[model samples]
Target: MKARIVAETLVKGITVNAIAARHGLRPTRISDWRRKAREGKLVLPADKNAVFAPVKLAVPAIAAPTPPVPVTTIDLLKGDVTIRLAGDTPAARIAEIVAAL
Candidate 1:
């Protein structure tokens, strides 16, 4: 429950005071959870918003230019099944797939 609250505050950008007031908790308690979350002590919910993807930069080669290839893919896993989609897939399409799942 505390982890959820902290995740809501961090991922959804909700103010600690607001969550505390809504849940009848002291703001300080929520702040403590936030600190723990920052310190990797609290386990928050798995959320795409909470995820940080690494970025890589490539230098151009002196050889003839080649067509740029798409290298990223979006993977959705549920149970024992996994679905992979192009990184450039439309948001609406992804939403439909998620809803269907």
Candidate 2:
């Protein structure tokens, strides 16, 4: 019962030191009582109509990951030589063609 009173006083915005002083106990004892109440070891009277303000969590919205686009390359255009190729074209073959050109 004493622990409950100290916990209630602490909940009412009173400092733990002040509550302990008022009850002729140490501040550590009041803190222990508060911890017990928080951990469900000590049950306080439920005030059915006690109103609390709404709380909003600042969580960001998750976005979908974008897929990688296909890549195609090679736009070799010279005086009279035109060579268009895909991205996977072999470097040796391209070098050979360019050497021939």
Candidate 3:
């Protein structure tokens, strides 16, 4: 489909505006195709020699592993509690845990 070609071109680093100009398509339509590609809903054409060639789908990159989080240990009258918090940990949950203790 014409839309798929535009999307594949866009995924290959071609600008959406350029694809629109080259294919005589509207820029908005090209943007829609890019969105579909990002969502994995667009079907790209396969090469004859490389049937499973990876298409550069417009997806977000996976974040690298962060450093180990600091663990805070509190000694209570009843018992000692150890709390481990990571860089990605939510502040609200940490507050709740501390409150419960």
Among the numbered candidates, top lDDT falls to 1
Q: On residues 10-93, what C-alpha lDDT tens digit does candidate 2 reach at each position?
A: 566678888778878898887888788888888877656689999999898888888657558786777887889887778898
Give the lDDT of residue 70 in candidate 3.
Answer: 68
lDDT at residue 19 of model 3 (Cα atoms): 73
lDDT of 3 at 26: 91
- Scored by lDDT, model 2 comes in at 0.76
- Cα lDDT computed for each candidate against the true fold: 0.88, 0.76, 0.67
Score residue 47 of candidate 3 by CA lDDT: 51
Per-model TM-score on C-alpha atoms? 0.49, 0.43, 0.40
Ranked candidates (lDDT, high to low): 1, 2, 3
lDDT of 1 by residue, 5-68 (tens): 8877874567889989999999999999999989999988887655587999899768987877
The TM-score measured for candidate 1 stands at 0.49
Query: How much is the lDDT of residue 33 in candidate 3?
Result: 77
After superposition on all C-alphas, the RMSD of every candidate to the true structure, in Å, is 19.7, 11.9, 11.6
lDDT of 2 at 22: 81
Q: After superposition, how far is residue 6 of candidate 2 from its true place, in Å?
A: 3.5
Please provide the root mean square deviation of candidate 1 (C-alpha atoms, Å). 19.7
- Model 3 accuracy (lDDT, Cα): 0.67
Colliding residue pairs in candidate 3 = none
What's the distance in Å from true for residue 29, model 3? 1.0
